[model samples]
Target: MDTINTDILICGAGAAGLTLAIELARRHVDFMLVDKIDGPFSGSRGKGIQPRTLEIFEAMGVVDRMVAAGGAYPPQRKYRADGGYDEQPSTEGLAPSPAEPYNLPLMLPQYLTEGILRDRLAELGHAPRFGQELTGFEQHADGVTARLARADGTTTTVRARYLVGADGGRSFVRKALAIDFPGESMKMRAMVADLSLTGLDRGAWHRWGDGPGQISLCPLMGTDLFQLQMPVPLEGDIDTSDAALAAVIAARTGRADIALHAVHWRSVYEMSSRLADRYRVGRVFIAGDAAHVHPPTGGQGLNTSVQDAWNLGWKLAAVVDGAPDALLDTYEAERREVAAAMLGLAGKLLEAARTRGDLRRGRETQQLDLGYRTSPLACDARGDDAIVRAGDRAPDAPCRGAAGQPLRLFTLLAAGGWTLLRYEPDGAGVVAPRKGLRIVTVGMDGELRDDGGHLRTAYGFAPGEVALIRPDGYIGALASDERGPALNTYIANSLI
Candidate 1:
């Protein structure tokens, strides 16, 4: 028998695992990722990138490729909610664009998103170990002992200082740790299939709530590519038979006949919102759907998981290399808050569909906000705030360098150190940062600020603003300037 010892053993090489893998790569942390699946992409899953997630990807330098692969535009479209299509596109987002305001949800399939993360991990010189399923784990003070079953019916034991479960809702790690996944499994079931939908807008997303059963038609990368989601009938069985499924759509959409193309993936998912009893149990932790599962109403599943990796990956690396144990606890505190809220928000969105307004009839789930708030750590003057809180993610705005090259605040702030950002060129007169603090100048040309629409609205940063952004991309403070009596002390404490 042979055993391998690694700094981290990540279970489930899906989005959360991939994101954590990439983050560890950036920090030079030694870890291994494993999944039971034979391939990279998974089920008929999530596809929408909420605004906050786009910023995170933009920081990781992978958004461009995601946009290229299958990221779509006009995220909101109308179709019969029960799964037959025939409706015009709809645009209800307050503002959607490509410029500094950074509106618009990036619409790409969930599998493509996972592929992008996996490709980046490989480019960073590591490939996840696939065809391995986690069997069980034993946790000691120093590390965790993990047993895995390989494709060829062989079993191997791996020891790691930490374990992160990214293996989706039915996580083996979560189950092994006896973590309770608490949430409601909804009675309604939704069917998702990626196929072709003609007579739909190529430029916008289409959905429908008017039918007896709620159905949706989403235009994908092009006019010919589309995704269909429909609610199962109240008394319907799990019927995949062609005639019955087609008949259901025809009865709901007033279209007796329709053309069909490739039905790549087809499956049903129950609306659920459940959280682990504890995101962290001893040295074992959970992330993505493993840590928390939610309703898909707001289209936040993939994006939220990516953010979870961003919050946890860096902290895990630091801990493995001898940072304080408190730093690790912060990951659970911060990301769990956001995860809980997202679940609630998704459920609310589903509930909202039951209501209607006078001006816009049949209006349901048409808009989503990139809304985020400040965590206590993001605003704390004390070191105790290391635990991640409800609202914290790096912000982005149209920015230019000293040479006037186009930049986003997130892309340039990954300077391999804690960042101090000031819209002003002079860095809000922040003196020599204690150490490990980087002073980044997000300067404006011949102006103190852009419209409130840019950085201000995206991050709620006011004019003449300055913020101490942590290296892992969370706001440390919002100041007009960094020159304050407690500033130096705060900087020194955060480093060690």
Candidate 2:
């Protein structure tokens, strides 16, 4: 077998794997991304992009394309047996603020989202090696050796300093590691598919019936297709043929006028929530569905998976660059907790869908408030009274550069490195420069001027304070005074 060497080997080139690959590529890290399928995923499975995920994409420099390719979710129109319908706003009363620019979830299909990421990765001079599947991998203290089987039956060996599994729910990597995935499968099943249909307006998400017979047909953005979702009996086998699907729609909606032109993709799934017992095993780690699987009610699965890759990507690159091996442990520590919380939220939404048929998504589903406040890497010299402290998402605010040019905090962070926002009142801080860190002073005459005081208000930091923003766009540490030893200590102890 041919032997290949790389700094990292990433399995399963889905959303998570692609995001990780993009991160590594932008950082100039050597890595390989592989998927079992011959090409990109063609389904519209995960179709909601949350606000937090939009921020991550902005950092990755693809948010513009994503926004252009997608649109806001439409109001859901629930139909009555008499043919009348009631409309409810999908995201009620959520508006974009300076601190949270992307408040509403964008309704884009998963296939399109992956396509955008893949395009960005290709621009970075790399693409996923499809038709190659990770058959097995073994890890040692220093590195991992993985075996890949191609579609043509040829095999190859890959030796890498780290291995990551972004595979789906039936992940071979997780199973091979013997990690316990303990969770109860709900007594509910659903059929989801993409279809070309007629006799319904594309302005609203159309729904019919409730409970076991509930059916939802949502218009997919940027495409002339509707995604169909309906409940199925727990025990019976579902017929996914186009004829059976049309029949089911006719039977449920009582409207023979609605015609199914074609079934683009279809899947039958039983609802289940499961979290891996562990996320890391020596030099190997799991992310996305490999680490946790959730119900699709809250649309958290794909967003959570993308964030998992975002959290792990920078840490993996840092470790490969000779950072302490312990730094990599924080990936599991932070993301697993987030996965557990998101899993519970998804479960609650699933229950609501089952019992009340209430499909209205609230602010909780936006995921803007999720953070690593309790992570070991977080350090806050500021008191607990601080609104935006250590481990919180570094909020964005409109400001001006020294040259009086318009700027945003996210734009400053788009360069992909650690940033220190020093609130120097006089624009004269004797802070020394450090490698791989960009120190931006926020003062009356600093590199960035909080002209409207929006930055101070959003970040909740007074002059003379400093906030250390992680590469992943979270505040790693906060200090009351820039001249204090706390900031340097945090850099030496937690950041490096």
Candidate 3:
């Protein structure tokens, strides 16, 4: 067997894995991403990208492509038994603001999103190695040893400083560690497929019937195909052939005009809500579907998985760069809480779909309100109630550069690493410089001038106050003064 060595070994090249790969690659970390499948997935599963995820993608330098490839969710058209249809908004009512620019979800297929991330990763001199399967792995005090089986019946031994499993629900890494996945499987099943058809309007999301026989056909953005989803009987084998799908659509919609030309990809899955008992075991970790599984109700699975990878990527990079090993512990503490709450929300939404036929998604599904306010890494010395706390997501605002040039707060933060926003009148500061950290003053005579006091209004920062923004875009610490002991202590303990 050939032997390979790397700083990090990431298994599975889905959304979560790809996000992590881009994170590491941009940071110039030595890592390897591998997937068992022969090529990229072609399905249109997990097509909704929430507003919060859009912000993360901006930092990763792929938001422009994602926006161009996606569009707003269309109005839902529910057909009644009398052949008339009722139209209603599919998402909540929210407009774009300076603080929250991307307020609504973007409807982009998962495969396209992964392709953009892959393209970004390749630009950074890395790509996922396909046809490589992780047969098993073992952990040591300082690293992990994994065995990989190739498509040609050959094997390789990999020694990595850390291992991350982004595999699906039945993850090999989670199973090898014997992690307990404790949750209930809802007694329901559904068939999801991508179909190329004709004779149906491509503007609205069309729905037919209700209860256990409801079927929906949603038009995919920038594609000639429609994604079909329908509930399946609980006790029988489902035939996923193209002809069978076409017949079922005809019977459910009571319309012979609609046709199904081809079924590109199809899958039948039982509704389940599960969370791993633990996210980390020594040098090995599990993320994405390996850590939690949810019903396809609120389109939260892929978004949640992306956030999981975002949270872990920075912490892992920090630990590898000689930061305290305990920094890695925060990954589980912060993300596990979020995964648990999202799981419950998805379950409730699934039940509502079955009982009340409610399909309207509210602002809670946007994932903007989720944060790590109670994490051990957050520190606040303001001693006053503020809209944006130490652990909340740092909002963006328009500002002017030192030379009177136009720019946005996100543009500066998107350069990666930690940022210190010092709200002071004078840009006079000789704070000791640190790698991966940048300090920018925002005031009348500072390096960045608040365009219209929007910066202070969004962050609630006083004239002498300062806020530390983490690499993952969360506020790590806030202090009353730039030269405060609280800020120094936070950096010394958590960041250094």
> How many clashes (backbone N, Cα, C below 3 Å) per candidate?
19, 0, 0
**lDDT per residue (tens digit) for residues 128-209 in model 3:** 9999999998888889999999989999899999999999899999999999999998989999999999988889999988
Better of 1 and 3 by lDDT: 3
Candidate lDDT scores, in order, read 0.67, 0.90, 0.90
Clashing pairs in 3: none
> TM-score for each prediction?
0.82, 0.98, 0.98
What does candidate 2's lDDT look like per residue over 201-294, in tens digits?
Answer: 9999998887888899999997899999998999977789889999999998888899999999999999898999999998889999999987
lDDT against true structure, model 3: 0.90
As for model 2, its CA RMSD to the true structure in angstroms is 1.1
Model 3 spans with C-alpha error above 4 angstroms: 425-427
lDDT of 1 by residue, 76-169 (tens): 5444446554433232345643333345566777777888888888888999998988888899989999998977888989999999999998
Per-residue lDDT of 478 in model 3: 86
Each prediction's RMSD over C-alphas, in Å, is: 5.2, 1.1, 1.2
